[model samples]
Target: MSLTAGGPRRDDFFKVPGKGAGAPVKPGEKAPVDRTAALSVGAFQPVVAAVPMPQRLFEHERERAAARAAGEDATRQLKNVGADVDVALTTAVLLLRGVEHPKARERVVGAVPQLAEAADYRPLDAAADFLGLDHEDAAEILEELTEHGVAGPIAEAAVRVEELRAQVQQADHEQLDELLEFLLPVSALISIAGAAAPLGALTEGDPHLAEAAKAGVVGLAAVALQELHSTEHPNVELESTELLEALTPPVR
Candidate 1:
């Protein structure tokens, strides 16, 4: 029997430039247009000169606006992270996306002080930052995701992940799929089960350590969550019935 090797790529080592990466955009590439600029342009009214404008122009503008909105939303979520925890958080996400970078790995494994710090790291934003996937990439992938399967459960799972993030304890084996599904593009949730589907292998054993040779969503995120839960950011004694219900493995 033959098997495929799933792993990081050469490009995974390079940091993807976000909105203000201070680098020029390549030809044919979309410039980092801010959300406001994209939206304002969308409301543009061309002066009529006794000629009907092409519909394609409006379609192009709409697409650009959408891309900016998605990108902006992702950026907003990441901006809230404190500098202290950003690298570790992002690195864990890189594992989830299967794009491990040396820099991220170094920080994730390096210091005890670094791991002990806690914050309200929003799961969706962390997922977006980790992948560094462009808005158009998300938009394009979303179409393919929707055409092939039902995505409602996957998106709902993303919400459930937020609840998981709020927990002060490590997640158990049963919540494995929910952990990964939260990272997938909503429209594609049921399609590939997330690009980092290999994370499923880490769902057993201690449910706490759930080790993997290659740090994955469950394994890497577990490290970060265990640290965050160490201090109990929201409340040490908080209880979440809804989160528990959402993670309950469905009866087959």
Candidate 2:
């Protein structure tokens, strides 16, 4: 009766037979695929990581900014220490010149406590007048302090410090570490007279004079610290920070 002998129409070319979208395929034949189905206009989004692209970009920018800020801060601090160190070097040289004094006789000890012990050192007010020199007078003062035998290890240490500073100027990392290992002893190097007497200012009446003397010793020590810690002012070998850290005891 009907012209077609079927359940559903299949006149359209490539249309599925017997069933619509879910039709089964005959043996040795491929199933129909719906190429015309609605598709998303943009990129296909598979499951992605938690932190997305925009946030990752922002994080990278933020970290970069922080690093730059830190570098600028370090540079400023280095310059400031350079000035402080210049005064300290002159004070130290002046103290060296007066090494024959009765009150002076301590060198090379753990920086935090050893050098500051007044019982171990004599007064250095004789060098006080030198502290007023220009902030950049370290070279001239170094020349003065380089007197052999009298300055002892202090002079030797200072020479090595300058060499290290040159390495720092060149930003030399390759050889810096080796030099640092050698300089560890430099930091501890101090020249002391054979025997130091007890506090000589007992009858001087002026306690401040003794205090002033302590200031010079401390100043010299401070210069040493600065030489090893400066990260800017275009200063010393081994980045100083790394060297100083190496001196610290490791965490258990």
Candidate 3:
């Protein structure tokens, strides 16, 4: 089900009090003031307070801290992996260039250097490109060199590069997951607030009714959001899918 099915319109949320739909003014009669509309905005504030806004704010801060820590760790790991990738690519390129094997020399001559430069900032891409170049009859040539005790040290550099590339990809995915985890609760709260707005609008005039309504709406919104969070709601899935598509690398 749509999370925001009956929520206020984007413009309605920002509309001035006493300016919404009201009884029309007759030709010479002054426009009647809408006390209900005027009171709606003030009434909604209590509803917002009824929800644990302060608690949610605290939780949001904690999530942000966690996300920041995850991001820093990912950055550190990627930096080390990038250095390793550069070293591995350089070793593989140099060794393949020196090899007398016609196919290996033909493949690594000038292409590897350009690919390396093209993906200079993108370590994962660089590793994949280098591995791709090395996989085509090139590994066999490197094995032959190893059998002859030639270029034996650099022969396994491609394998090391592949392992390093996997680490980079894993680090990136972990960072994305952390970001998504932080965002999920934020989205749920926004949905809850929107759903609660209309219910709060109904209790404008009576102070006691307003208080009771605020409590009821807050409880209802909390329950609804909890259920939506636990279930595989289509709206939640759509948001997650969009975020993944936007943040994930094309190479993966």
Candidate maximizing lDDT: 3
Residue-wise C-alpha lDDT for candidate 3, range 1-252, written one tens digit per residue: 122121212222122243222434457855533222233333434433344322333344344345456665445433433333223222222222233345433443333333224332222222112122223233333333334323222334323323322332333533323322322333333333223332223343322222222222222222222222222223443343333222222231
Determine the backbone clash count of candidate 2. 3
**Predictions in order: lDDT:** 0.25, 0.28, 0.30
Off-target runs (Cα >4 Å) in candidate 2 are: 1-74, 101-152, 164-252
Q: Please give the ranking of all candidate structures by TM-score, highest first, separated by commas.
A: 2, 3, 1
The estimated TM-scores of all candidates read 0.17, 0.24, 0.19
Candidate 2: lDDT of 6? 11
Candidate number with greatest TM-score: 2
Q: Poorest 10 consecutive residues of model 1 by lDDT?
A: 229-238
Worst 10-residue lDDT window, candidate 3:
1-10
Cα lDDT for residue 27, model 1? Answer: 79
lDDT assessment of candidate 3: 0.30
lDDT of 1 by residue, 1-252 (tens): 000111222221121233232246677865532222222221211211111111222233234335455664433222222111222222222223331333334433432122122122122222222333333432332232223211112223322333333220122222221322222111111111122221122333211111121222233233323222111112101111222222222221
Give the per-residue Cα lDDT of candidate 3 at 83. Answer: 34
Model 2's alpha-carbon lDDT is 0.28
In candidate 1, list every pair of residues with a backbone clash: none
Error of 1 at 172 (Å): 32
